[model samples]
Target: MKLIFGIGLFLSLSLLCYAQEIYKESMSLMGSDFEITVVSENEQAGAQYIQIAVDEIKRIEKLISSWDQSSQTSEINRNAGIKPIIVDRELYNLIERSIAISKITDGAFDITYASMDKLWKFDGSMTSLPTPEEVSQSVARVGYEKITLNEDEQSVFLKQPQMKIGFGAIGKGYAADKAKEKLMQLGVKGGIINASGDLTVWGSQPSGKAWQVAITNPMDKNHAFTKLPIMHGAVVTSGNYEKRITLEGKTFTHIIDPRTGYPSQGILSVTIFSEKGELADALATSVFVMGIETGIDRINQLPNVECIIVDDSGKIFTSKNIRINNNEN
Candidate 1:
């Protein structure tokens, strides 16, 4: 008999309503549901594999969660500005990659954005815009260049006294990448690890079909505007609609522009597809802050990275290989 065999007819008939031979499990992690799925000849086997992947994802989240206050990442943050603190290999690499993207985007994508003070409230309580000095002071602590990385010692340092770093934006993608890696290491041929909306997948369905993913319409969250195929990589979407606070007559998204110390405007959503989830996650926010023209230009320069951008007017733009297949036609 094969190591994994197809479901018997009796078992298949019991769960006939399921459209695909897929098994899925949803777990709570990183403040959202982390879902994993495996498609195989047998639903039972697929469920077992998905559980394994979800377990590994939960394990990683516990280690790296900054919100936990007891996690390794939080420890590094607590010691910030005092001395260089060594971190795990995973966090060290993540910081390295984030700095590289920050350099490439001219500081538009910065992990040190946490250094900004909790000023410029966007709740519907303010009547006047913040003064230029207030804006400047808020971002005085948010320069990625001030973050020193000692590669030989694998330590990270924030030069300013009040400076801090957080991984709220890129943590999901890193978790997705780790989950996918763990599943593949377990000898699973194909699966998807979705950390919130940051997801990665590889191989083919047991039926040899491509994995399909839909891009949401920013104006209408209920409907998907496009469906794209995922052969062997990752996809991540960031939207201004998700987190926002309104003040007076204006609405400010939670995504801060590191340069201005204010919320970004114009773009509504950004979706990135790349070979690595980490790059896709970081690039999605970077492109949103950079706006369309510069965003497209930056993504075009990177290897194995593609982006789909929706502006405030709902205008859609895409990179070379990203096809926005409107399901209407």
Candidate 2:
């Protein structure tokens, strides 16, 4: 169904001052909300930097957006099984990394997920489950193994005619990382690039306090219970509590497994902290599909990466390196 989804609401710590004020600009980009914050000397400089950040994100969209018919991503899909499409080096690198991640996650996170046919509805309209044959056929063309990459030619090709790729899950985070890089290169001392709930922050706020993220309590769903202080890193939280598909008396989230062609269940939300927003965003979705136990174990194996999982029972789980303290701000 070409689903474009993001996490729940996240609250950021913002502090301002007269000498060096914190300026923020919020806008819609890549079919999702984005906020760019920077530490600037005055309102005029802040405006210019924000515009620069916005322009960089727009450039990324032009490269990776599947909805845009002229985008390179669309061209790759159009040439599936016909011929390899030469793409920009940036795009080739992104696809290469995506394939690596797919291998490690055991098909839980696959860009070829776009190859799946939309056979289920999440708006309570689906009262009966699709036949087993229908479910299997929906994901027949969805396989990461079918995607081929040639580094020498900087080209991408799909072995199957119906195979397709989309970056709906990781594109926002990639754009956020790119925007942060552009802002930092232009001499912006401190800032944050928040693409919906996937965020990347560096330096500190103008008031000198470390950047903090307040994750929503799954039990409450509306109010945040704990605040996590991050000196510098990326945090991406993915959840499916808002949308669900009902078949018979069972309920399923909107996040479908590309391999099994079934909705992932058991975990309510997953928040991943990593060195890059792209990794954090993809890992968050991967954890959801991997379930609670396996997800925590996989995250613990990676160095400098941690995750917080809230299961359907409102119970919280964390990786080996994480320690949640509600007392600490």
Candidate 3:
């Protein structure tokens, strides 16, 4: 009887250990691929959780997508310089936060950048650069200060008629954050939401280890320069390796600096890790526009945020708090 009782206890422990399994689902949403992974005891539960995440992301896209004429974001852009449009609390808050990020980054990350004219093309068909006057005119209406928010009325107004706001940079990350939050609320133990490359994770893998993320090398797209062990939080990478144009023997990236109305130069890619995907996404773009020196300085001032910047010459610059493992250089 004693031997039988011991065997039963051991079998119970084994069953418990086998119950923890990780499941994943990937699909296209918000004009990008969204991958959701969750740990569960069975496949059904995992699928259900992933579905919930998918539904939540779709809901957010409907609310914030500028392409959707009925979306509040579209309404705000349409009425730019015309009238203040009342918006849902969620969108109002997002715009408010975007403005705050613009202030923090000293206009390096501006939602009003949407107002800039597309003077530069990166499709390899461009033979010459735009004239200096044309470049200057392109960003005439781009200014963060032009965005006005009314807290009492929950309205957003663009002071200039031609000014606009778009979330091409931060929307995916924000959706990732919201999806993660919703999953956590649904009692998910562990999961990852990867919106295009803006990834956010919570909890650990089924093996009880942290999630591992690889930072792709801008120069060599197939290889990763470093890998990071992330237990929680978010990671976002902004790079111009794939989209760029060369004119007069100078190569310009697709990422434009709104302040100067020109493509940002000297940085191939910038990756940022932060507590929220929204912050990480915006900062990655901001750093690319800010350049290495000012960008690294700004990141160093923020606690719990780290960055890795690869210059145009393949030089790597990291924030003071970051320690890279298996650095290629």
106: Cα error in model 3, Å: 0.8
Clash statistics: count for each candidate: 0, 0, 1
* Model 1: lDDT of residue 72: 70
> If both were scored by lDDT, which would come out higher, candidate 1 or candidate 3?
3
Model 3 TM-score relative to the real fold: 0.94
User: Could you tell which candidate, 2 or 3, scores higher by TM-score?
Assistant: 3
- The C-alpha lDDT values of all candidates are 0.81, 0.86, 0.89
Question: Which parts of model 3 are misplaced by more than 4 Å?
Answer: 1-14, 325-328
Q: Give the alpha carbon lDDT tens digit for every residue of 275-312 in model 2.
A: 88888888899989988888888898887899988888
lDDT of 2: 0.86
TM-score preference between candidates 1 and 3, better one: 3
Ranking by TM-score: 3, 2, 1
Q: What lDDT would candidate 3 get against the real structure?
A: 0.89
* Candidate 2 displacement at residue 207 in angstroms: 2.0
Tens-digit lDDT string for candidate 1 (29-64): 778877887765577777778777767767777777
